[model samples]
Target: MGNSSSLHLQQEDVQAIQDETGFTPQQIERLYSRFSSLDKAGKSHLTREDFLRIPELAINPLGDRIVHAFFYESKNGEEDKVDFKDFVRVLAHFRPIKKNQEKNKLNTRMEKLHFAFRMYDIDGDDKISKEELLAVLTMMVGQNICPEQLLSIAERTIIEADTDRDNLISFEEFAKVLERTDVEQKMSIRFLS
Candidate 1:
């Protein structure tokens, strides 16, 4: 109620925010500090400068703008009360679905990804050539668990999986597909639903 940094935010607000936003504690601290500094009325107010200043906040995946807007509205009393629950709601709007960053990171199953890469090394060429192993991979497609890429899937999956352009699927590269725990979890949710 007072324009004081004395308003020490408890951990519940932070925990709830993190649960909703998937933001690390460090990020939350930085954000909280930024907002706390804007005690315009002993109330609170986020200015356009605040938005422009926090360069790390991105609107793309997390909808950072929405979170900022909510905070601004609550602090300025332009909206209703500024409860911790409200903060959670704001964070939820910016929450990152798991595996988003990792999807681009290195492979989870370095060995397996490598195996998938070399799995199509037909003609015992020791590497998957661009020629496309129709017979060998096609035969194993339905049989194997993940199965080989049967040319088309192989073309895309390989290209997507291959971080480097060495024209081979090393275990390091192949593990990326298997390491998507977040995606796998979501798939499980859909299955049960």
Candidate 2:
């Protein structure tokens, strides 16, 4: 542990999480192990770099957006880091449960989508503009893409996502973009055995 203070999860905290999330002790321990692995310093905070280094996330299609959301969704200004509580909250969206809780799943998906939208919104305008969308894509693509090609891609994405055609993606529009069953299937996370 880099700093003792950074690691704040007590037994009570574990029990609390179990009580709230209905995760078994084994599952909670698995989550804790993951947190510990990412918290190399044992620091409670998981930085953006730490998140990006995860092999699974690095290859995930929505990895960048999810990383962005992880930071942006922090109640406290986690800045570039997420504490354990926030981490758990984020993971709640992806619990590997066989028994379908349709309402919970839908709500979690919406929350995740909203976080992603905020990540793409750039200026905190509660809406995604073409420029912002382009910037995010550019960040994701780096120097590999030409400006014109990026612009065209952004325009197409906006057109596809902007159902009402207001040229901006509101939460509703963003939800429509991400709400497909296929997308949900792809985004779903499988918990560690």
Candidate 3:
């Protein structure tokens, strides 16, 4: 198992991750070191518990959803764990879209929106229902607002964004609502080189 982890950190594999994730070699190495430290079992993969154990994430309002997004790409019945490659790939969605960045599909505005959409589309359905939006809103601001106010806010949000009047916010509707907002800048994170 230890050998497998080292294999992924090899030069060739690191290059592949860099290509797919738009992470610099240095960034990949740094993230891999963090991943290693988080993988107390040294299995080259992280479990939900490992992610939840992070002190910052423990108190983050969106922490659970962020953690869920990391495992969203899991396949072959490994839904509970995220390998190093997938971990980096998920993080790639937050890479700032530089004016001269290469054509990295993963870092596009659409991809970033989709990542945010998935947080509200908790059921994995292609649309965000009122209940779904309410659930997310509660997660974010439930502590400050009462239940009635939260539900009202969620309903208003859905009504405003549901352009087709379908009572649910589709991806197109969600995108349209955010059309004026600078998703590129808002979704990006500065990755240390």
On TM-score, the candidate that comes out on top is: 3
Q: How many pairs of residues in model 3 come into backbone collision?
A: 0
Tell me the tens digit of each residue's lDDT in model 1 across 110-164.
3223323443554445555555444445544444535444567667766776678
Candidate 1 regions with alpha-carbon error over 4 angstroms: 1-7, 44-88, 100-193
Q: Each candidate: what lDDT?
A: 0.46, 0.73, 0.86
lDDT of candidate 2 over 37-123, digit per residue (tens): 998887678999999999988986568777877776676674777987677767765564454743343235565566556768888
Error of 1 at 56 (Å): 12
Number of clashing pairs per prediction, in order? 8, 3, 0
Please list the Cα RMSD from the true structure of every candidate, rounded to 1 decimal place.
17.6, 4.8, 2.9
Task: Estimate the TM-score for candidate 2.
Answer: 0.71
- Which order, best to worst by TM-score? 3, 2, 1
TM-score, per-candidate, Cα-based: 0.29, 0.71, 0.92
Scored by lDDT, the top model is 3
Error of 1 at 5 (Å): 11
Off by over 4 Å in 3: 1-8, 75-77
**Which ten contiguous residues of candidate 3 have the minimum total lDDT?**
1-10
